[model samples]
Target chain A: MSKNNSRKIKQSVFIILMLTPAIVGFFVFYIYVNFKSVVMAFSFEKGGETFYGLDNFIRFFKEFTLPDTMFKDTILNTLKSFLSTIVIVYPVSLIMCYFIYKKIVGYRFFRCLFYIPAIIMPTVSAVLFKYIISMEGPIDVFLMRFFGRNVPDFLQDGSLAMGTIIFYSVYFSFGGNILYFGGAMNGISQEVIESATLDGCGWVRELISIVIPMIWPTFSTLLLTASVGIFTASGPVLLFTQGGFNTYTISYWIYEQMLENNNLEFASAVGLSCSVIGFPIVMLIKWGLNKIGDKVGA
Target chain B: MKGSKIKRSISQRVVFAVVFVLFCIYAITLIYPYIFAFNAALKESGRVFTRDMVSLAKPARWKNFVDVFGEFVVSDSGYFKMTWNSVWYSFGGTMVKLITVTLSSYVVCKYRFKGRNLIYNTLIFTMVLPIVGSGPAMYKLLSDINFIESPMMIFTFAGGLMDLMLFAYFKSIPWEYAEAAFIDGAGHFKVFYKIMLPQAMPAISVIFIMTVVSCWNDYSAPILYMNEKYPTLASGLYSFHERIRYSHKHPIFFAGALFAILPPLAIFIAFQNSIMDKVFLGGLKG
Candidate 1:
């Protein structure tokens, strides 16, 4: 074999070797674990019997358990979280990036400061906020002093708890949106703006006609991502609530039911139900967006 | 003309200055909590609880740092070997991710391989699936196969496939660049290692930093897999916090969390611009 052929063999072998751990782990751990979860979902634990078939799933569907309430809450929280991301986070990010892109002075400092939250670990953020939202924390203390009123327990209150979690979801992801929007803004050429100005277009007109249109593809991508995340968003609730409150999401519910509750079979049934629910909702949203996108293109 | 130009420039400066100031206030609010956590970490136990919540302590308690480090249990003779273990896992896990993702993404995005579209869509769909829904099925599988305890769990089974990050970056690279290398008689590996890898450095760096930071700070996986022997920084923070839950709540726990998060935070500040640039621009151009 020539030197090139030998090099090719070595590289291929190394790449294959590098990939071996992951491939083996995926099959053994992920594929096998899930397959067993399916089996266990049908049967009860502790007896070690095989091929019970559909009983666990039937129990899940039939029983009015805590997991059922949790399932409903999870779906609601997921939808609420998505709406919050879309309505608040995305628009705010676009506007903030617009200001920064226009170099609205001291942009560098502002940009750096806004981006800090993105880099912090989610667990740390949750713990920090735990202190911040405490009765004696600055914000609550101030509220106690200023209005002569007690600051409500943000985490424990069932009605307000979901909203509080959703609020952090937006805050945690806000930095990423700024970065994406800023990049999109930067992609708009100066020449296009100048030409639009020469054509007697106002600043607003230029932005709407040129900037928005130019970044439509990025918008489409973010929209799809935002929608998909609605079905599966996990961070704030996981780190903050630990799915403790009535605010337990589908994901957390599955986790608790499987691991903590030791209803391995029931958890798998719920997991399957979630996948069944989420997959179609996601597909429908995408189909709708694509239809709108195609019409816009047309 | 000069007078009008001067007025326009002045107005522009004023507008920019106002935006800057408003944004500063917003940034400060977001930053204040973390900065307070840092300060809380440095405060002595007494000062942490009794000191005015808003005021800085007179003499900082640096011993909180020592307490966190002391929690790491190395066998008979080894000290800080746990940290070394974490470092190994992070690096090993990231290496696994980089190789699999790069190859998988390359085949899908670049090569006209069979089952390409099916693979791509499935991966993306899986990526978006909620962690809770997947956890039960995944945990049972890992446990049954005796993978729960292994370090390999970090890279392959647990966390994520990271296909989205790799796919977004892979799709962005122009076909022409890869084609040019092929035309020059570069084999696939040669093109990947030398040409494609170099071009995709920004994406690689982003993924590398993210993987390392995530692995370092991860709490759940270590709690699940390592059990007692090797806990990552996040789990360590949780353990430390739980140990001294009452009196040391303010400073010591905050200190541990701060110390746990610092390495990643420092990296973030140092490479902030590059990270942001890669996140948006690198994936959007193509």
Candidate 2:
């Protein structure tokens, strides 16, 4: 056999060996499941995967178009939760990261404290917060002692639950992003910043001109990912409130649907229907952000 | 002008100190939950509701820890077994992950194979697509396959994000080392497993730690699919919480939560630098 032919055979064999796990994983985990899901979206779980012929889709739509339907609140709340993090977590983390990056007094201490929550179980964190905010918990205890009156029940009050959930999310979301941004900031050569300092750049000016511009790539990367986070952000609601009190994000709604005695197909259909709306919105936002970032050259 | 500038500078320093103090206060707020848990877990049992949460009792209720572990002993709901299950899941999943990520990534980065970009782009496309309601579908598939209870499900699913990062990391590695290894009569397997894998260790380790931490913390998937028989530490802890919420005292639950959190916390502290810093860099710098 010719040497080149033998080498070609060897290469082909190697490629197959390398690609098998990925191919299998894709088929088993992603493709097959998704294909089945798309089909399941057209069926009813109550009837044991019996064909429903867009009935589920119509039900999903009715959930939005009709008043007192669930789909509207869930999708809206999901976006609201995502936006809350964007408003609170994104900037605060950047600022906190800047402080840590500057190696401010006790920055190391603060960094560890901030990052610890990201590693702990979200459920565990939720439980901690739940205990703290419960009627008999610290928040009430503190308020009753100091102010001679207790605040409204946070977890159970329909009005306060969403805010409480958002607070929990934003609080925990801080450290990981700060670590990411701080790491990116650390990548900026010290000489660049020191030279700016020598040139008498104030903190605000340095942050605006040098830091933001230099870290633009990482910033854009995170921003683009945040667009995808729109659909993904449910904010530990499963553990927090079990998605009750007007707090059911789409993710939680689907989780709740699946847990029902006869809603697996209904859950699959609702998920598919939401994705139809959410997927395009996410993609559009990602594209819009990318264009803006590139045009700004940030 | 000079006097005004000095005055301005002194005021700025004062402002900075005040801001630092305020930040310290804010940081306490961020950390207050854990502190409250620790204090509550140690305080005298009946006083948890009445006493200020921040105060540490003279004789700490260390029996909280004993109660948590001991309660698990009388029942089939084994916290130790669940933790062991979590360890097994992390281990087994990470092993499968190293294969799926490292091998495919090495191939994608190295070989000029047919349809390589197809493989790569397929991954990117799937990632951007919203997987918002993918659970029921995945659950159905797993159930259909009779594989719902096993830990292997967790292993195979670590593909998308980790693979993308691994591909980028592998691409950045210089090809000269592989060439040298090949010249020394090493085959494809040796070049991948020995040469490339070691070089890719830093990036790989970051993903490994991430997978380990995430698997240890996961509650839903195990609870959803694994049923009552083989719950992970997370789901097991969750079930234990629900079971004992009204029955057990607050200290016991707090101790259980603290124990549940400890392993991942240790892992995070150990790898805080690698994860927070190098992970973003490694995962993104493609």
Candidate 3:
């Protein structure tokens, strides 16, 4: 074992040579880039960036302390959509996943149909959604008859835009999540399912008790990733609102800062703070889910 | 008891029927858009402008589809250039991802180097640590380094999700194959390319399809990084949308979208078996 270990160390030069590209990439992309973000977050760069001792952070917190600022709206918007993802989107998709897994009536056709959109460019789906939901589009025409005149532009109205975005997101959420949970359920031995059935377990009971517990890793993984969506998900906000009409997200804030505003220092500050705050929350959610899984599995 | 069993079955049938109907409605919502978009893409501008929605085909004017591809893509260049760009992006991006991921994961799996766990853990750690801040920093780095047009940014380290799965995949390969090659005086490169890389083909294929589809569809990256000199299919389509959005000609818009969707859609439909093999095997770990 010691001889093998020494030889492995001797091959360390070869290993280093093999790993050069990725290592350099990791340093340049991950380390150096993140280091700059953190540095810029601390420093105020509008008038020649210098370390200003948390002034940028202070400015962000003070400004976003306002109930209606862009920063506040972005954070709020991210939360609303992310919450919907957790509460509404995931559960609905999980149910869809369950049905698909069970091969419930035209599953293959339905699976292909749903999953195809995910593989297709989001640009395509975004265009399609925009086509239908635009002012005086099909939905508008249908609703125009109901209200008889002046139906709300679903993607334009401040009150309705987030809902529209969420709806579109949930509409496509069926694609990957189904394949995933289906794959997980497929991993479960048929003998287990058959024995459960023979023991007088119905589909619902068996799923809740046997299948879900078995697929805990997959379930928790999806849940945890979705939890992190609070910081990351910017779905159709870019298309729908362009960070306007009370639809800014943290991600959109970062984007708007870069493209529209060119205030990278402030964007860095906000972005850094979001991740710093978000990291613990994400970890908590993951830990809590794992704990629950342990209890349920037990 | 017999009556109870029958009642139970009757209720089950009703439940099944309800679920089926619900799922059918859901499936229609998912699929009907493509059908609508296809027919709309074949319509005349005059028909599209009509307020009345009609399912009846009014002698399908196929010119809209052709015009969308030929006439008004981003700038004077048409669909062909953008198609080439899309091909470059996906092909280049997938190649880069495979090389970077396969190499890095290979090292971690095969080597007993110090900091292997640290590198692996850090990569996993960084996945959840939102890199929104890094966008502008990266933009600065790219623009300053003059690699915005180079597609070198796409070649950077990745596999935030795939890292562990791929590591496991590489580790699962019998080390004897590599050892045999090494004993025959095969260098690391020879052994990796010849023995190990081919062995990791299933996982690599999953990563390939994912990266290609994503790179093909990804609009934001090129729009952010590259100028009109290197417009990808996705970014080109987006730019065209900006130009033609107010034209109120639904057919052309639908045609452009359909054009953009076709490649990735065709790829998915064609290679679904392999895609399913990965998804079923990997279980959407990403």
Predicted model with the maximum TM-score? 2
Encode model 1's per-residue lDDT on B73-147: one tens digit a residue: 323212255566567777787777676666666655666534557666666665554323556667665666676
Which portions of model 1 show Cα errors greater than 4 Å? A1-40, A43-48, A64-70, A258-261, B1-21, B46-52, B71-82, B107-132, B157-191, B243-249
lDDT tens string, model 1, A61-144? 666366545456667776787788888888778777777776665677777778777766666777788778766777777887
lDDT (10s digit) by residue, model 2, range B1-286: 1232222256557756776786688788777888888877776654444445555655887787776766552137565776777788777877777768777878887888788888878877876777666778877777777777775576556444228788888888898998998899898888888888888899888888888888788877776766467877777767766665455556766777788888888888888878776767656656
**lDDT (0 to 1) per candidate:** 0.66, 0.75, 0.74
Give the TM-score (vs. native) of candidate 2.
Answer: 0.92
How far does residue A32 in candidate 1 sit from its true spot (Å)? 5.2
Considering TM-score, which of the candidate structures 1 and 2 is the better prediction for this target? 2
The TM-score that candidate 1 achieves is 0.83
On residues B50-107, what C-alpha lDDT tens digit does candidate 3 reach at each position? 4543354478878887887666467555778878878887798778767766788888
Candidate 3 lDDT, tens digit per residue, A1-298?
A: 9978865665876788767767777777778888877887776654564655788788888997876667766777788888887887667777887777666667788777778768877777877777676655666666677877755677777888877887888778767777777777777787787787788888889878988888888888788877666677768676666766677788877876777538788788888888878888888987899798888883
Question: Could you give the candidate ranking by DockQ, starting with the highest?
Answer: 2, 3, 1
Model 1's CAPRI class is acceptable
DockQ for each candidate?
A: 0.38, 0.51, 0.48
Misplaced by over 4 Å in model 2 are A45-49, B1-15, B43-59, B73-75, B155-162
